[model samples]
Target chain A: MLNVKDVKKDFPVLKNRDVVYLDNAATTLTPDSVIQSLKNYYQNLGTSVHRGIYQLANETTEKYERARKKVADFVGSDSPREIVFTKNCTEGINIIAYSLHHWPEMEGKILVTEMDHHSNILPWRFMANGSEKFQLEYVDVTKEGRLDLEDYKSKLSPDTVAVGVPGISNVVGTVNPIKEMTDLAHERDALVVMDGAQWLPHRKFDISEYKVDFLTFSAHKMLGPTGLGVLYGKEDLLCRMPPPFGGGEMVLKVDRRKVKWNDPPQKFEPGTPPIAQIIAFGASVDYLNELGISEVNEHVDRLAQRAVNKLSEIPYVDIYGPKEGESRGGLVSFNVEGVHPHDLATALDSLDNIAIRAGLHCAQPLHEVMELNSSARASFYVYNAPEDVDRFIDAIKEAKKILGGADER
Target chain B: MKDKPEIYNQDVVHHYQNPHNKGKLSDPDFSVTEENPKCGDRVTLQIKLDGAEISEVKFHGHGCVLSIGAASILTQMIQGLNVREALELTFDDLVENMGNPAKMRKDCASLSLNALKKALSGW
Candidate 1:
């Protein structure tokens, strides 16, 4: 069992603040090891990577690339060459969409689900926009906020070129059957792109097991530094696909008329990369490895289930996502009757300084389909405990009383 | 403003539950809808002018306690006031009429005023 008290000690924010932070779905708290690694990089080795000839530059480059290998190993990829660093998860998805938009063979429809964040949706929308050869389609989401597999099977035609699905809904907390979906999409000869932003933090994901053509996630959401994201693509697929953006270090030979791209990972990562963030991410991976992803996931699931059970008992509270005891991510999205999400969020804050996300959570299409104006979400992390959940439940009742929840029966 | 649960303030709850001048004006002289992109709350403010003054003013659409309550309170305040004077009524002025929570989320509190300004910017 993962000890919450020990994990909480690693996070300075938890020790410093008396606030209950339940917004882990948005971003996880940075731990001391990751922060120390960042400070070490800036304090000692302040040189750029993949360029300079001196020992300091070469040493920094070694550390930077070693971080990539650690991340690759953490995700169970045999080769670090498959991992490409980008600005964030959004940029990684955009890179794939950009590369596919330029591919001559990419045609017909680009499919995405209603649960996808704007990061996954807008890139495809921008790709399909004003293009005759390409079209955008949305897989239906059931009333329970679950992905409609029947709708997905119906839409997975031969003409479907790609499917961008979330491994877990950021808002609804629905843990998707990504392996099954990937297997099905592969049968149709369609490329599957999984948004792993929510999955990576709470679960163990082996690329070979899922066999997704592309997986994109942010390191910041997994106790790593911000401004760094990873794009894991199949070796052959990365080799075949073209890099959309071009700059320094991405190309080996720049001809007078044409340029020869370097390789898969480097070609995708143009210009100077986020050196400090990448180095710190390696420490984050080490941190997770020490805790063990399975134990962390199980601990989170227990707390989330506890939250679901307690919330279900409240007559005025409505919860979204997978039902109690069903598989879900580390968050719970809910709404208080007759109280707007913003009002409820504010009331919670005023009641006990409980920090929760209160808005669309960047899945506006999902909210629109669900017929909700906005919703409040309480997300959990490694540091969050059962007591935190109880405090949250108590705060909800108090907040409801002041917010005039429902019509008082 | 931060310490108190402003949305549940007796005045805000009363205004939100029983909004004043919430219906549409027929053959309205000016009508505009403004949205708080931050939280996705919307407010549509409609007005009928008699000479230089706002003869009738009403607000409609979906929003939270601050936005809806502020719109309800502001419409009642704007009645019979000169159109230019209504435009002069700043967010702070509206908060003074209502409560101080409006100052915290000024965008939501000023949504109705933003619509009114958009509808009358041509003048």
Candidate 2:
């Protein structure tokens, strides 16, 4: 298990006396190492990469490539050639959507899950609207928030091009069986893209073991700076797919009449990149590696289980997602009877300075399927502790008193 | 103004705990549903009219404290007003009624006010 005290010290935000942050699913707190790396980049080695021949540019280029390799190793990709840096997870998914225009035959029938984040759902839906050959089929999820594999099996057809799903759900904290899903999709000759935005920071993942065609995640959600994302596709596939955006650094040569694009990863990464943020992201990954993902995952699982057990004891609290804590990460989405999620969130905030997310969490289809308009979610990261969970539970008890009793139900 | 606790301000928790005139009015003169998908704040308003005057108003549904409180206070505020006057009510009026608007509270307060206006349209 990770030394929770040491892990907490890495994040400076924990020093704030009045803030109990339980919103890791929205974004994680950056560690000092990552923050310092960003500062060092700006202070000393600040220059554009790939385009310059000067000493500073060469140093910047080497650091940028090293960062890419670090990300490649972190995700277990075969080579750094497959790693394409984008602005964020949303943009990464959009690249896949834009590539769908090149494959018209498979556009009409794309398969996605109801539990997907809006970033995963909307891009394909937009493509469907723009092309007659494009349409979307959705797989149902179980009441406990696990993917209904039987439903997914039925939804996969010969016409399906790809199945976009999440590695971990932002709302429910359900860790999907992505390897099985990807294997099933590959058997049907369809590609699979895993949204790892909620998964990467909390646990260690190997992309090669899953053999997914593409993987996407954001740095901000992983304790790095915002506006940076990593998109990993197999080198062969990346070479076949054209760049979605075009500008400097992404082209080999350009004339008024024609332009030749760079290789797989560089072709996709255009414009001046978020250099400091990417370097900082590498630092965050290093920090996570040092802590060890196995320890981090176990710590998070223990915290979630403890929270579930404690929250379940509260008279009318309705915790959603898998009942087994082992099947979930360090997040719990719940609602107290007779109290709306927003009211519960506000009450908790007022009572204990506890911060939690209260909303549909951009998973509208999932909420609609579950017959819930919204929910209150408390998500955890390495920096969170058992005391945080205790405070959260106590706040919920106080909220119950503030919003009246369970008798209203 | 009554030395209200910061957490128990007339604007903060009152409408959520004891909402005013909540529920549907069958065969009401005006009705509408307002929603803010971002925060999952939803409200359904039903108003009764006697000629141009709103005789009664009620709201029902689920939302944050700010939203529920605003809806409750709105029913109390608009009960005796004319349909035109209620229609003229902006989100600012609702925020003002709830004391002062915080940066984030404005959206929740406005959602109920917008629902009220939409409900008043056909009346």
lDDT winner among the candidates?
Answer: 1
User: What's the TM-score of chain A alone for every prediction?
Assistant: 0.98, 0.97
Worst 10 residues of 1 chain B by lDDT: B1-10
Writing each residue's lDDT as its tens digit, candidate 1 over A122-209 gives 9999989999867999999987999999999999999999999999999999999999899999998999999999999979999879
True contacts kept of 2: 0.50
Minimum summed lDDT over a 10-residue window in model 2 chain A is located at A400-409
Candidate 1 lDDT by residue in tens digits, B1-123: 234444456787788878899989888899899987657898999999999999999889988888999999999989999978987888778888776673457777888988888888866
Q: Rate the local accuracy (lDDT) of all candidates.
A: 0.90, 0.84
Docking class of 2: acceptable
Q: Compared with the true structure, what per-residue lDDT tens digits does model 2 show for residues A83-165?
A: 99999998999998788656444555788898999999999988888567778888898877889999999888877789999
Best by TM-score: 1
Q: Which pairs clash in the backbone of model 1?
A: none
